[model samples]
Target: MMDVWKRLLARWAGGSLGGGWGVVLAAGVGVFVPGPEAAAQIVNVQALFDEATAPMGFSGTADLSLDWRTGSTNLIATRLLASAQLRTPPHTVLVVARGEYNFARDELLVSRFLEHVRYRYRLLPWLAVEAFAQHELDAFRRLRARALVGAGPRFTLFSQEEASLVFGVALMGEYEQLRRDGEVDAGQERLDPRLSSYMLGRVKLAQNMSLVETLYVQPRLTSVRDLRILNETLLVVTPNARFTFSMGFIAAYDAEPPATVSRLDTQLRTSLGVKF
Candidate 1:
């Protein structure tokens, strides 16, 4: 009986002691030990992969609402759009970043740029036309001498959705001197073929979508140039009216080669577009 009592007391003591040690060990690990996979991480997954896209349209969003962010969609254009606010005697400048589509590329370049700043008369209520000659750079690359001249009428489509619809046509001549980087061509510059009579049709899509279709006839390759044309059908989405994320096909329909550049060919490009 004494032996049995001794055994019971010893077992109880051992169990309590064991539990105490376990509690201490667990506390130590929970307080001081590092996590399992700390060393392998190089870049912050949030920063590297977070969808904080750049701003698109030209006119800036108001300071307060600018804080909200979107997770799904992207900004494809940002521009400083100027519409007429003829409150005073003469309708004056209203600075708003208007989202717009790029010329040759179906992407939106910037919201509103000073295409040509000049003194002109605001002739009609919603219609204004002008002509100007300016040096044309790819606008994105501000390089390669391409001169653009002539102008067309810009009319306001004042619908319920805030003049969101605009249609215009422009006629311009282009001299395209296609040049490659020095490392690739080794300082050899060729007189790249020129494209004349570049025609443009600017079509307004949804609230944040606009489509610009450009048709340019290749100058030199009489057959390919005669037959060669580049048309990009683009879809632009405005996440919060400040930025745009764009993706689309370069050639919607390309004839077989003998001619270069195809139809619905992503061979040219497929990537993210951001405007700042």
Candidate 2:
């Protein structure tokens, strides 16, 4: 049973964290958007916690992605993600941070930064209690800042060499500040209580290849209609122990978004990750 837990932690270490693909195609539009903009509120923090590169002690990973094009429209996009974890007996700690910038034809299109910290206590081989806090900002989304904190229990439905599934639910308290633009009561400070839930699954396709899927749903406790959803599917290819490559697709939706913000967003991205 201890060996199984070790295997599960090791598998989580391979998962990638925040940021999006450099080339973005807006949903419902066949053409690529001029800028690689995305919603930063829904990041894959679970990836940072799941990957266990080492059975004990501390481990870290860094991933960088860039897209640059020159010609009719000069464009540059860059993203960086870093994560570290410490494991000690029944207690584990994890931290992850990410930054992104995009420029097109000398104009800034996207800029965002995010930081997250999580702590977990393993009460059993198949169950853990977790608490987390996160802070994020996005220039494209006109978000000045957003912060949230939550705690809950997580259940490992199944775990094996070939596949795994996990589910979790939490009560989250959130606050946000948005930038105003000529709208009445725009940029107002807001606070809300939300129910956050997620499901994560992984499947090994081959000796060096695997697939991961994650889904997140957060609904306002006061009004279920005010909901947010995020989904990501990734195909990861590992050539060796230290390096990994992955291609992924992501989609996010907010039933009630801030003024001037779109309710839905999508992205297609590829990234190279290094673990140590």
Candidate 3:
């Protein structure tokens, strides 16, 4: 029996059980056969392995909702959101897209869409390099279209099982087109340089619930008067491994908006999501 156990240990040390499973076996023994201090060390080792392996795969969420009302005033509203992440060890790619439409009295009240893609590569344990691109259109804001491309460095402030925070700064180039609204010119392209910074936070609120928040600020490199701020907050509840319910809020502000366009916009959303 002693020789058999030694052989098993030798195989485990020789990487015969695959990298993660050896750590799992060690953690199991630490938790079951040892004292509290050993358990803590096991947890730290597991976390290190998790960070190193990074769980290469694809994960995503999609949301769709519609509302219709008939009375003195008829209204219809539709919303759609989708986000996905593909992780390949030390590299990750992400995509997010959303659209909203509203109609009242058979006339369109609002129409807008936004899409973004980002890629990140881990350069060190707490540092990463990132690149991103985005496109947006809002008929209500008289924004015909906008495109942006950027690159930057991201730093992980903290990471643990219960909470995490990350911050990034980037230099971006933007191309914008506005509809002809008094002072604004139609079919005209405006290109500018901007500095952008963002902080993202995630926290576990309960056994089955989590909260995520992101704040972003962007200002023209030449003048701070031309600035934009965006905030997004979400609460998610999971009843099981495969399904989630979420409520989210988004607020955006522009210091210098196009003519006839509001400087501030806000939205509330609720969604049910499935995991695959």
Q: Is candidate 2 or candidate 3 better by lDDT?
A: 2
lDDT by residue for model 2 over 63-167, one digit each (tens)?
Answer: 886644222223566789998988887888777888988876677766778767777788888998777766677766777666555677789998888998999
Task: Please report the candidate that would top TM-score against the real structure.
Answer: 2
RMSD list, candidates in order? 28.8, 12.9, 18.6
Specify the poorest-scoring 10-residue window by lDDT in model 3.
34-43
Alpha carbon lDDT at 137, candidate 3: 68
Tens digit of per-residue lDDT, candidate 1, span 25-137: 33222221100000000000111110112122222222111111111112333323332211222222122212233333464343112222111123565564433222222
Q: Which residue ranges in model 1 land beyond 4 Å of their true spot?
A: 1-122, 132-144, 155-166, 176-230, 252-276
By TM-score, is 1 or 3 better?
Answer: 3
TM-score of each: 0.33, 0.80, 0.72
Whose lDDT is higher: candidate 1's or candidate 2's? 2
